[model samples]
Every structure is written in structure tokens, then in C-alpha cells.
Target: MGQEFQGGVGQVAEGDINNYGININLPDKPEFRGLVTAQRKELHELRAKCEELGDDPRDVWRRVHAQLGVCSISEITAEQFHEARTVISGRLEQLQEEADKRRLMGKILRSTAEKDARQEMLNFCDLSFGRTQLSHLKRNELQRVLEFVQQVEINPQPAAEIPQVQTAEPLQLREFLLMYKTNAAGLFLFGIFVGRFWS
Candidate 1:
């Protein structure tokens, strides 16, 4: 009869045989099975979250490993799991914020009248604020640009005035000629009527 080891698997007796003559070697720290399972599930969830946020899961894992001083997720202890979760969650939040800002910028640019309004805004930002991309601008700077664009839309610049042609002299001469012709015809008719009445 073989004695069962009360300690961890690390101190298990070598060459332990089962009833079917198969040697079984248990994993280290059998008591940590639950913790290990939970940690793996959390890691998978974190990776999915990274994908949803359009971030690289590998980079997230790198940050977690660096923060927790572990090469692999399996090596992370129960205490370190919380720290790793915090790091990953914070990164996801940051990514989400950046994505939202980008979406808002896109919406603002699309609301403009010009077909290439996005490029125009990019140029404006570069010239006025020294930022080539809207993404580079801070929240306040973006707000300023938004206000300026809205103001421009509200009060557009006036179009150039058309030059008037010099036709006043011609118009006056034409009117004078028309009046003279009318008066001459009226006098001729009056003279003819007077002669007929006398006859």
C-alpha cells in the first residue's frame, strides 16, 4: 500500500502507479486550480475586449506582464490578477475615449457643405493651430475649431460685387429721341385736322 502525500504536488512520490499500472504526475499547487481557471477566463475576456476596442491584444498582454512582473499569464498569482485587470481595463477605456473623439470629429467634418470638407478642415487646423490631424488636437482646441466652423456656417462671407456697365448716356439719348419723334407725329396730325376743319 503506497502512502498518499499530504503536501503539494511538488513533493509527490516519484514513480507513483495507478491501479492500471499507469504513472500519474499531478500538477503543482492543485489547490490553485480554481484561481488558475478564473485567471484564464479573465485573460480571454481581456483579449476579446482589446479586439473590440481595435487595440492589439499582444500589446495589452505586454503591458500586463510588465506591470505584474510575469512572463506569462499562467505565472500570475491571485493577488497580481487584480492589478493586471486594472491595467487592461484602463487601456481599454483610453482606447474607447480616443475612438469617440475621432467619431465626433468625423461627424463635424461631414456636416460641412464642401465635399472635401475633411481635407479643408485638416488644412485649416494645420495653418491656424499647427495641427495637421484633428486627432492630434486636444478637447479644448477641438471645441474652438468647432465653434469657428459653426460661426462660419452661420455668417458666410459676402460675394464680390458685380461691376456696372456705363450705359446712362446711351439710355438718356434713346429716351430723348423717342420723345422728339412722338411730339413731331402729334404736331403733324394736329396741323392736318386744323386744315380739314377750316375747309
Candidate 2:
């Protein structure tokens, strides 16, 4: 008699099964199963990291394939999968470290500069972290901040040299009128000189 195939949801074999004409051979050894499971988990984690880093999943997978010297993920062996996992995990850790560094720089920027200045800095650096909200920046934005920080480190600027932001209230009516009159007088003299020249 032929080997009996169980008929239940959980009784399905470990590998892909197609009722048509395709056949996929799954490893029977427990260790091989474990390795495949680990490889899939690591691939999932790397995909998640790619999303967090705002990178294309296909591109990241291609890079992983290149790093492991494999043509495709499907062809990756247990050892190669382990190496890929290590490389991906290291990249994730590096992104986390960069995010931490960006947070520190944001704190410094907030402490030393005003909201407008911080916003300007973010704009110049092509970052998306808001002036009032710098708690959790995306990886790319954090990288932008990291680059800005490195530039600042290379050409150090004194803290005292940073421009101060004026958050004072609007001027009073009398103060506004006085200032307007002073500016008007200068403009009047300049206009007279120009008019005389034209005449």
C-alpha cells in the first residue's frame, strides 16, 4: 500500500504543496527545519528594517544576495542565511545608533537654538523632524541629522556664536510710531536726493 497522506489543516507537510504538477521537497531533519525557520525569520526582520530605513525591499534583498554571494534568496544555504542575518542585524544596530545620535543633536539644537532656527536647520539638512516634535525621527531623517552633526563637528562653531531668537511681544503703539517716524525721515531724505538727481 502507498504511504497515507493525512487529511487535516495541521497535517499538511512542512514545504509548499501544489495539487497540480509541481513538487517541492522539504527536509525531514529537525535541524534543517529549524534552520529554514530561522532563515525565514531573519529575512522577515531584514524586510522590516528595510521598511524602517525607507528602502525598497527588492533593493535590500538584492544587496543581501550580493553580500552573501548568492543569486537569489531561494538559493541561500543555512550558512549563507546566518551570515545574511548577521549583516542585516548589524545594519539595524547601526541605524539605531544613528537615531540615538540624532536625538542628542536634536536636544542640543533645541537647547541652544529657537524653534525657527531649529526648523531652518532641519530644512537645510533636508530632515522631516518638526521643530516641536523631535522625539522619533525616521531613519533617513536621522541620517540627515547625523550628516549635519558630522559637518558641525568637522568645523566647530562656538555655542555663543549661534544667533539668538527674539521671542518678545509686539511693540507698543508709541514705540511702533517712533520707529516708523525714524525710518520715514531717512527715506524722505533719500527720496529728495534721488528726485533732485532726476530733476
- Model 2 TM-score? 0.38
**Can you list the residue pairs that collide in candidate 2?**
none
Query: For all candidates, what are the clash counts?
Result: 0, 0
Could you give candidate 2's per-residue lDDT for residues 1-199 as a string of tens digits? 3344544433356556545544556656554322487668768877798669655677767777888787777767776767878767766677667766666766657543533345445565553455434445655665566556445522344566767888989989778768799786888799999999999
What is the model-wide C-alpha lDDT for candidate 2? Answer: 0.64
- In model 1, the clashing pairs are none
Most accurate candidate by lDDT: 1
Candidate 1 local Cα displacement, residue 148, angstroms: 5.0
Worst 10 residues of 2 by lDDT: 1-10
User: What is candidate 1's lDDT per residue for 91-150, written digit by digit as tens?
Assistant: 888887887778767666865554435555666688889976777887667776676565
lDDT against the true structure, each candidate: 0.72, 0.64
Q: How far does residue 175 in candidate 2 sit from its true spot (Å)?
A: 31
Show model 2 residue runs off by greater than 4 Å.
1-35, 114-199
